[model samples]
Target chain A: MVRIRNLRKSYGSYQALRGLTMEIPRGELFGFVGPNGAGKTTTMKIIAGLMRADSGEVVVADRMLSGKTGQIREMVGYVPDFFGVYDDLKVQEYLEFFASLYGMDGKEARRRTAELLEMLGMTQLRDEMVDGMSRGMKQKLCVARALVNTPELLILDEPASGMEPRYRRQLKELLQELCAEGMTILISSHNLNELAEMCTSIGVISKGRMVMQGDVPTLLRRQRETNPYVLQCLSFPEEAIQILKSDPHVKNIASSGTNISFPYDGTEEEAAELLTALVAKGAQIVSFYREEGSLEKMFLDMTTVP
Target chain B: MRHLNPVYKIGLKQSARTKKTVVLLLVYNLLLSGLGLVVFYLTFDRAGRVREDVAYSGILTLYSVMAAMEFVMILFIVPASTAGAVAGEREKQTLDILLSTKITPFHIVTGKLAASISMVILLVISSMPVLSVVFCIGGVTVSALFVFLLLLVVTAVYIGSFGIFFSVCCRKTTGATVCAYLAMIIVVILLPGLLFFFECLEAFGSVGYIGIRNVMNTISGKRTLFLLFNPVISFVSMLRDQVGRGISIMNSIGSEGGLFYFLSRHWFAASMVSQLVVSAIMIALSAHRLNPTRKGWKSGRSG
Candidate 1:
C-alpha cells in the first residue's frame, strides 16, 4: 500500500534520511524500528504529506505523494508521536471536527464520530472535555481522529509512547483489528516486542538507511542461522562447555555457573546429535534449547554498528 | 452555498463557547455604556438643563467616540485573536496533524483569518445598539453607519492579516503577537509622525501668511496622502465627513495640482483598496509559508 524509493532528506549538513527505500503491501501491519534520530519519523512525515523530501518518490495507495497531497492525504491516516487536540472540544465534537475537515457532511461526520467513539471505547467520555482526559485517553482520541476519514493506510509514529501497558495492549489489539479489516498500517515505536507480537512485517533502520526489513518470521529465521543455544546444566557444566568448544558447529562459547551458551550454525538434526553427544560424555543436561530469535535481538543485531 | 470550511467552523465554535469571550463582550458593552453616559452628562448645561443643539452635538460626539473606540478595539483585539492562530497550533503540536489532512494551506490560512474577522465583526455588530443612540438625536444616518461598519471590517482585515502573517512566520505565539503589535504601532503612530515632520518642513520653507496658509493647507492637504495609509486617520476623516463637514482636509489637498492631488481626491477609496491589497498579499504569503512543498519552505524534518 506504500512504497518509498531512495528517499533522501537533509537538514543542512546532517542527512536525516539517506537513500532509504521500502515497500509495504496492502493489509500489512508493518513495524518501523530504529534508534533515536534514525529517520523513522521523517519517512512517516514524508508519506503523510506533511514533509517534502529533497529527492525521491513516495507512492501511497497508488498515488504519488509529492504533488498529489490531497489524494494521498485522503488515503492515509497519520498519528504523530506527539500531537495535541483542541482542549475545549468534547471527545465527540473533536472527532466530528476532523471528519468535517475531510469534507464529510454533518450527518456522515456525526455517524462516523459515534462509530469511532464506540469502537475506541470512548463512548462513555463522549461529552467529556478533552483537556481533562488522561494522556492515554487523549492518545486513543488521536488514533480515532486519524481513522475518522476511514483511511486505507495508517502511518503512526510511536503510537504507544508513554502509555501504560494496558493502553499499549489495547492500541496493539486495535491496530491488529484494523489490519484484519484490510487497513494497512506503518507504525514506528521503541517497543520491539509489541511490534513483534502484532506486526505482519518489520523494517529496521539505522544511520538513515534500511539495514534490514522483511516479514517478521523471515527476519527471525535469518537471524536464527547464527542463533545461539543455551545449555543449562544440573552438573558437569565445565565438561559441557569443553564438549561444546570441541564441536565443529560451535563457533564460540561462554559459561557462567551452571549455564553454557554458544553460537551454533548447524541443522536441527545436527543440534540434536550434538546434545546427545554431550549427554553421552557425562554432561548433565537439565535443559538444552536453541535461543528463540526475537525482533529485539534481530533489530539489535542488524542495527548495531560493529 | 458550499459547506463552511471546517477549520473556520471549529474555530468559531470554540471561540464562541469560551467563557472568556462572554466576559469580554460584557465588559466591552459596559465600557461603551459608561462612555455614552459620560457623553450624555457632558452634553447638558451647568444648571442641569439640556439644550437641543448641544444634545445633538453630544450625540454626534458619542457616535464618533463609539466608532473610534470600536475601531481601536478591533485593532487591538484582532491581532491578539489571529497572532496566535497558527503559532498556537504549532505550539500545541497539532499543526502536523492538520497539515496531514486534505485541506490546503490556503484553506487553513483563510479559515483562521475569517474566524478572527468574524469575532471583530461580532464586536462591531453588538455595539450597534449603543451607536443607535445617535440616531435618536439625529446626527448619524443608516448609510453613514453602514459605511463606518464597512470601514471597521476592512481595517480588521488589514490588521488581522498582519497578525496571521506574523503567526505563520514566527514559531511562537508570543513572538508573533509582539511583532504584530509592533507593526501596528509603526503603521498607526510612527509612520504618521514621520510624515507630519516632513510636511512641517515643507510648510516652514515658504514665507508670509501664504506660508501659514500653506501650513494649515499642508495639515489639511498633502499630509492626508500619507495619512491615507493609517486606518485611524481614514476612520477619523470618514467620521468628520459624515458629520456635515464639507470638503475634508483630504479633499482640500486633492483640489491642488499634481499626483498628490489625485491621491488626495481618492484618498479614502485608495486607502481602503490599498489596505485590502496589502492584506491579500499578506494572506497569500502566510498560505505559502504553511505549504510544505513550496520551495525554500522548511519541511517537517527540519522543523
Candidate 2:
C-alpha cells in the first residue's frame, strides 16, 4: 500500500511533479498512466526513495519513506524502464549481487535466486552472460533482480517498453499472478490496453498532476453516462430498430443492414425486459450485448487538452 | 566480518574476469622485468671496472630507482582505475538500480575505491621479485621493502579516492579523468613549486624591501613541510632513509621549533597520516555526492 500527499518536485525552473496526491490499497494492481513528462516516473522514483521531493509526504506500508530509506528499500522492488546489465556477469551472479546488497546471506540469496530464475523462466539461461541476451531477456532479469528481495510492493516504470508482445504478455501474466499472491503493484506504462486488462485500479496523470484515478469499471462508467448496446438479428432488422427506437431509454439508433446499435440508459432489469420484448415481437435476434468502453478511449478523453 | 561488501565483491570479480586485466598484468610484468635487466646490466657493467663500494652504491641506486618507478606507476594507474568508477555506472545507467538497493552511499564509494586500490596492490606485490634484486645485492632490507609496499598501497588508496571524488562530481568519465589528473598535477608539482617560490621571495627581497634574513631562515627551515603530502617526495625520502643516508631527507631540510618542523622531522609518518586523512575526506565527499535524499544533492535523470 502507498499513500502520497501533495507531492511537489522541481528540477530548477521545470516542475516535474506538482501537488500530486494518490493512494493505493493493499493487494491492488494499480496502473499509472500519463503522457511524456507527466511526472509518472518522478512519482515512482520518489516512492522508491531514489529521489527527493521538493516537498511532500510519501508513506509506504504505513512507514514514512522520505527520511527512512532502510525500511522503504526493504518494502519496495523497483524496475526502471531502461537499465544496463553487467556485461561480464551471468544471470545468476547478477541476482546474487543484488540480493547480497539487501543483506541476504549467501545461502538464502542462492535459494531466492534459483526460485526467481525459475519463476521468470530464466533457469535455462542461468549461466548465460547477461550482455549476450536479448533486450527482453535482460528486462526480465531486471525484474527478477527486483523481486529477489521479496518486496511487498513492486514499483515498475514502463517495464514493458521495447519488449516484444510475447514478453509483454508474459510480464503481464507474471504481474497478475504476483498481485493474486497479495503483492501490491504500481506499474506505469504507455500501453493502455495492457494496463486496462491487468490493473485492478487506474490513475491518470497530466501536467504534473493527477487528473483522475479510480477503479477501472468505475472510471469507464463515469466516462460515459449510457452504455452502448449492439443488437444483431437474422431478420426483421427494421422492425427491431423500430421497436428499440420506441423504447424510452434507447437512443442514437444506427442501422447497418441486419445489425442495430444504440445507447441504452437503463438498469439490468430494463435491459432484460427489452430483450424479452424484442423476442416477443417475432424478431430473430442473433446476439444482443452491451459494448464496453475501451480504456484507450477513456485515457484519451481524460488526458487530451481541453 | 560485516559480510564482504557486495559492490566490492562484484567489482573485484568483474575486474578479474576481464581479459584486459590479465593482459595489463602481463604487460606490467614485462616492463618491470625489462627495466630490471637493463638496470642490472648497466650496474654490473660499471661495477666490473670500479671498486666494490661502487657496486654496493649501484645496487642502492637500483633500489631507489625501482621504488620511485613503482610510485610513479601507481600515480598513473590509480586515477585511470577509479576515474571511470561512478561515472561508468551513470553512463551505463546502472547507478539508479544500485542506489535503489539498501547499500549506503558510503559503502558504494568505499567499495569502488577498495576495488581499484586492490588492483594496484596486486601489481605492486607481483613486482616484489624485481624489487628483491636490491635485497640480493645486500642494500635493502626486507622491512624496508615491506614499508615501501605499504607506502605504495596508501598512495594508491589516496589517489584512487581522489579520482572517485571527481567521478562522483562529474557526469562524464572523460571529465572525471581529466579533473583527477589535473588535481594530481596540482598536488605533485604545483604545490611544491609554490612553496619554493614563497621561500625564494623570503630569501631574496621582493619589491623594494630588503630580504629578512631571519624570516628567510625560518621559512627555509620549514620548507620540507610543504612536501608532507607529496607522494614523490615521500617516496624519495623513504628511499634515502633505507639507503644509509643516516638521516631522512626530511630532517635535513632544516630545523626549527614548530609543528611544521615536527612534521618534517617525521615526514614518512606525517605523509601517510595526511594522505589517509585526505583520502577519507574525498571518499566522504563522494558518498555525499551520490546520496539521493541528501539536501543540496542533485538527482540524476532516471528512465
Candidate 3:
C-alpha cells in the first residue's frame, strides 16, 4: 500500500508535481493515467524513493518516508521507463547480480534468478548477453529484476512502452497475477484502454492534480448515472406515456410523439417490472436503452480542455 | 567481506572481460621490459670497465625506474577507469536502479574503488617479470618490492577516490574525468610546486641560490607538511629510506631538528597515513553526494 499526500516536485521553473495526492491500497492493480508532463513519473519516482519530493508526506508500505530511502527501498520495487543493460553481463548473471544487491546469498540469488528467468520464458536466453537482447526482452528482464527482491509494492513507470503487443498482454496477465497474489502494483501509462482491460482501479491525473479516482465498475457506473433511459415507440404512444407518467422511479420525463426519455433512479428489477407494466398497457416500445460509459470516454471528458 | 558487493563483482567482471585490460597488460609489460632491458645492456656494457659495487648499484637504478614508472602509469589509469564509475551509471540510467537497492551509498563507492584497485593490482603483479630484471640480478630487496607495491596500491586508491568523488559530483563523465585529473594535478604537480615556491621565498632577499639546502634548513617545518599531500615527494622520500639519498628530490632534506627534518625522516609513513585519511574523507563525501534522499545535501538549484 502507498499513500502520497500533497507531493510537490519542481524542475527549475517547471513544477512536475504540485499538490498531487493519491493512494494505492494493498492488492491493488492501480492504473495511473495522465497526459504527458502530468506528474505521473514524478509521483512514481517519489513513491519509489528514487527522488526526493520538495514538500510532501509519502507513506509507502506503512513506513513514513522522511528522507530515509533505505527503509522504504527494501519494500518497494521500481522499474523505470527506459533502462540500459550491462554490456558484458549475461541475462542470468544480470538478474543474479541484482538479487545479490538485495543481500541474497549466492545460492538464494541463483535460485531466484532461475525462477525469474523461467517465469519470463527467458531460460533459453539466460546465457545470452543482455546488451544483445531486443528492447522488449530487455524490458521484461527489468521487470524480473524489480521482482527479484520480492517487494510488496512494485512501481512501474510506462513499463509497456517498449514491450511488444504480445509481451504487453503477458505483462498485464503477469501483473494481474501478482496483484491476485497480494502484491500492490502501481502502473502508469498513457493507454487508458489497455489499463482499463487490466487494472482493478484507475486514477486520472492532470496538471499535477488527481482529477478523479475510483474502482473501474464504480467509476463507470457513476458516469452512467448521467444518461437517461430512452423509449421510442413506433405506435401506441399514449399507453406508454400513461405507464411512464405513473412510474415513481422516472423523473424529468418528456414525451414527443412516440419518443420518450427520462432519468430513472431504480434497480434493474424495478425497471423490468415497469417495462412489463408498459407491455400490459399496450405500449409498443421500439428502442429502450441507455449507452454504456467507457473509461477512455471518461478520461477524455476529464482531461480534455473545454 | 562476508557479503561481497554486487557492484564490485560486476565492475571487475566487465573490466577484466574487456580487450582493453589485456592490451594494457601487454603494453605495460612491454614498456617496462623495454626500459629494463635497455638498463640491463648498459650495465653489462660497463661490467668489466666499472668497479664491481658500482655495477651492482645499477640494479637499484633499474628498480627505482620500474617502480616510478608503474606509479605514473597508475596515476593515469586509475582516474581514467574510475572517473566514470557513478556518472557512467547515470548515463546508462542504471544508477537509480542500483541506488534503489539495499546497497548503501558508501558500499557503491567502496565497491567501485575496490574494483579499480584490484585491476591496478593485477597490472602491478603482472609486471613482476619486468621488475624481476632488477631483483633477479641483486641489490633491491624483496621487502623493498613489497613496500613499493603497497605504496602503489595506496596511491591508486587515493587517486581513485578523487575520481569517484568527482563522478558523484558531476553529471557528465567528461566533467567528472576533467575534475578528477585536475585534482590529481593539484596533488601531484601543484602541491610540490607550492613547496618549491616556499623554498624560493626562503631564498629571497639573499644573493644567489646560496647553498639551497643550507637555506632550506632555516625555513619553517610546516612547509614540509604540504609535501605530505604530494605522493611523488613522499615516494621519493620513501625510496631514499629504502635505498640512499641518490634519488631523493626532497628540498627540505637537511632541516636539522626542525619539523621539516622530523617529517622528512618519516615522510613515507606520514604521506601514506595522511593520504589514506584524505581518501577516506573523499570517499565519505562522495557517498554523501551519491545519496538522493539525503536532506540539505541536494542543490536547490536543480529543483
TM-score of 3: 0.89
TM-score of chain B of each: 0.89, 0.89, 0.90
What are the per-residue Cα lDDT tens digits for candidate 2 across B218-269? 3554555667778877776676568755333444454555775676666777
Error of 1 at B275 (Å): 1.4
| TM-score of chain A by itself in each prediction | 0.96, 0.85, 0.83
What are the per-model DockQ values?
A: 0.56, 0.54, 0.39
* Runs with alpha carbons beyond 4 Å of true place in candidate 3: A227-289, B46-54, B206-219, B246-260, B296-303
How high is the lDDT of residue B248 in model 1? 48
Instruction: Give the per-residue lDDT digits (tens) of candidate 1, residues A1-306.
Output: 888899998988889989999999999999999988899988888888887888998888888877648888888899988857989899999999899889989999989999998888889999999999998888999999999999999989888888888989889999999999999999998899889899999999898889898999888888876778988988875565677778898986887988878888888999999999889888888898888888888888777878
For candidate 1, what TM-score does chain B get against the true chain B?
0.89
Query: Top model by TM-score, which number?
Result: 1
Evaluate residue A158 in candidate 1 and report its C-alpha lDDT on the 0 to 100 scale: 88
* Candidate 2 lDDT tens digits, A97-193: 9999999888988899999999999999999999899988989999999898898999999898988999998999999999999999999998898
For model 3 the local lDDT of residue B123 reads 95
* Runs in model 2 lying further than 4 Å from the true structure: A224-290, B49-54, B206-226, B244-254, B301-303
Residue A272 in candidate 3, Cα distance off native in Å: 9.3
